[model samples]
Target: MAKLDLRGVRKSYGTVEVIKGIDLTVDHGEFCVFVGPSGCGKSTLLRMIAGLESITGGEVAIGEEVVNAIPAADRGLAMVFQSYALYPHMTVRQNLSFGLENIQTPKPQIREKVEAVAKMLQIDMLLDRRPKDLSGGQRQRVAIGRAVVREPNIFLFDEPLSNLDAELRVDMRGEIAALHKRLGNTMVYVTHDQVEAMTMADKIAVLRLGELEQFGRPLDLFNNPANLFVAGFIGSPKMNFLQGRTDADDRNRLILDTGDTIDLPEGRFTQAPGQTVTLGLRPTELQPDPDGALHAHVGAVEQLGSESYLYGTFQNETPVTVHNPGQTTIRPGDKVALTAKSTAMHLFDTETGLTLRG
Candidate 1:
């Protein structure tokens, strides 16, 4: 296991800068996940660390050595690409042994390494089967096993489960997490799926348009997002944002665009009156309240077995989503009252799109 450090790292494609200066640290054996939407530069950053992409500036260090100019093969890191990248004509055993063979590892040591990794990955029975004979998940395991045989100081995965079916994706996700626990190897995984990052990472680094937005534990980023973008990006079903205008002084409150007043606790707004702002409320935080003051017209309801998501608009057509237990009979055009606690609310400066508190 090795600690990884990125200091003022950057990358560019000619005049277009894709990765701005980013500084990050991964402790020994820590599973760090880089997550963001498409075009967010997560993969670019990962490839830079693996030495596959030349760093335009700054430095990358693994353990205690600077590896900015090191070749990918000599960096002691193995990357599992999104495509699996297995040799179609080679058996799982041959694929696992290929890297060792390339470096002229002893024949006995190569065989021993292949057997040990195959057994550890529980693919011992499929060792002789070529890539074409394996299922997608099995092929992915073979790719991972190939990495394992290298005994790399660090492992990098780039959306390795994106091609699999939903069920297979879940299964493979568990396998990856378990593999990390069993091997205790330092790993960096890049994914656009927030759920995968939430479940698998010891720490998550969120990036947007070449900038590091937030870095923290999964739940910490979910619970207390540093800004509006991080808030909207980290959670499933996403958070709802309502445009509002600050109404008064001494006591702060936002009058929703729908002409409904959302009362805030004292001192909630430090911005000037009439300042445009956004009020953020998570779906789970918005619930049906029989006697609540706020009412909305239902637009649609989606039942996902365990829970329901209700989408609707206020009388003024301001959109909102309400999370409900089980399934809901609330159909389109139905009028319903909903309420949310002030503690569940998040405030943001509309102009800057930055969170505002204290």
Candidate 2:
């Protein structure tokens, strides 16, 4: 296993800069995920690490060796693509063994490696089947097996599970996680799905518009985002933001545009009074109460058996969502009051979008 490192890494096309200067490191045996929206440069960054894209500036290193000028094949890394890029004419075993054969590995060695990977991926039975005869999930397993047979220093996955159906995706996720446990190699994964990043990554790198927004443990980004963008992007239902201005009389109070007032804990506001700020509250943090600080008019309700999500607009018509336990009797057009503890609130400077802490 090898640790991957990027120092001032950048990629540009003429005047269009896709990847600004970035510095990151992936420790040996670590499962790191790059997650962001489309065109956020997560894929571009992965390609740069794979040596498939030329770096405009800076160093890409594997372990202690710089590999910015090294060819992809010589980088000693294995990649699993989003598309199951299996040769249609080759059987599963053949596809898995083809790479090894290209390197002129001995026939017996190739067979042993293929058998081991096939069994580990639970695709041993499908070895004789061609890609045309295999299911989507099976084809994906074959693609991963192809990578595993390489025994590279690091494994890179570029949205490998994006093509499968929801159920299949979930199953493959478990399988991939299990594979990582069994083979303990450094892994770098890129995906647009925050859910996948949250569930699969030992650490998550959140990106936006070619810039690294935040990189840390999943729960760190979830509970304590560095900025408004990170806070708004990491959670499932997404954190709700309310426009408000700091109260002049009390530094620990904010007056919302909806005409409601939310009390913050003593000495919570570091920004000056009268400064516009945003109050962020996660869906699960808000609770229904008779006498609550905020009020909303429910517009829609989504019941998913175990929990229900209430979607609505606040008094100011700003969209808000609330998570309720089990089923809720609340219906569309129902006006409800919601309350949350001051400790659960997140304050951000409206202008800079940076968190404002006490």
Candidate 3:
């Protein structure tokens, strides 16, 4: 296995700078995922590690070796792409063995390696099938098998599951996780799917607009996002933002626009009184209460078998969502009173879009 490191990595195409300077580290035998929206320089960053793209400035190291000068073939890493990129005419077995053959591997060793990988991937029966004869999932497995045959120090996957149907994608996700557990090789996977990154990665690196937004464990980013962008980006059904101004009601309370006041400990907002700020509330954080802090008219409801999400407008003209049990009786246009659990509440500055921490 290898440890991959990037130090102030920057990429520019002529006058246009696509990837701003980025610094990241992937420990040996670790599975790190890079995720962000399109044009966020995610794929460009991956290609730089693969030596498919040249670095404008900075260093990429694999296992203590600086690979900025190394050729792609000598990088000691294997890549699986979005497309299967397999040989159309060659059978699965031949495709897996092709790489070893090019490196002049002995015939007996090549046969053993191909058989072992095919068996491990549970594709032993499909070894004789050509690319056209294989299912999408099978073709993906073959692409991965080709990488396995090389036995490289690191594995790189670029949206390898994007082509599959939802069911197939879930199935292959488990398969990839199992593969990683079995091989224990260093892996760097890039995908726009936050679900994939959250589920598959030991650590996730979130990117936005050519910059690294946040890098941490999935739950860490979910619980305490660094900035407002991450606070809104990392969660499902998104957090609700309520426009409100803070004011001193008594010795220790910050009043909201709707006359709802949050009791605070001493010195909570010493410098920002009467400041316009946003109250960040997650759908899961809102609870049903008879004497709740906010009142709203439910506009719509979504039932997801185990839970329900309520879309509504607050009295202060702020849109909000509340998540509750699947058996909730709340319906569209129903009036409801809800309370915000302060422990689950987030506060952000209106001007900078940054979270306010006590």
Point to the candidate with the largest TM-score: 2
Tell me the deviation in Å of residue 200 in model 3. 1.0
Cα lDDT listed for each candidate: 0.90, 0.92, 0.87
Q: Write the per-residue lDDT of candidate 3 for residues 1-358, one digit (tens) a residue.
A: 4999999999999989888889989999889999998889999999999999999999999988999989999999899999999999899999999999999999999999999999999999999999999999999999999999999999999999999999999999999999999999999999998889889998899999888988888899888877788888778878887766766445345566755666544554332767777777789888778898678889998888898889888876678889897758888989988887877777778788776766
Query: For model 2, what is the C-alpha lDDT against the true structure?
Result: 0.92
Give per-model TM-scores: 0.96, 0.98, 0.93
Q: Which candidate number would show the highest lDDT if scored against the true structure? A: 2
Against the true structure, what is every candidate's RMSD?
A: 1.5, 1.0, 2.2
lDDT by residue (218-279, candidate 2, tens digit) is 99999888899999999998999998898887767889999899888777658787889999
**Model 3: residues >4 Å from true position, as ranges?**
248-271
Model 1 lDDT per residue over 1-358, tens place: 4999999999989999999999999999999999999999999999999988999999999999999988999999999999999998888889999999999999999999899889888899999899999999999999999999999999999999999999999999999999999999999999999999999999999999999999989999988888899999988879988888887562376788877787776665456677788888898988888876577989888889889989998768878888897877778878998887788788888899887765
* lDDT of candidate model 3 versus the reference: 0.87
Q: List the residue pairs that clash in candidate 1.
A: none
Query: By the TM-score metric, which is better: model 1 or model 2?
Result: 2
Clashing residue pairs for model 3: none
TM-score-wise, the better of 2 and 3 is 2
What alpha-carbon RMSD in Å does predicted model 1 have with respect to the real structure? 1.5
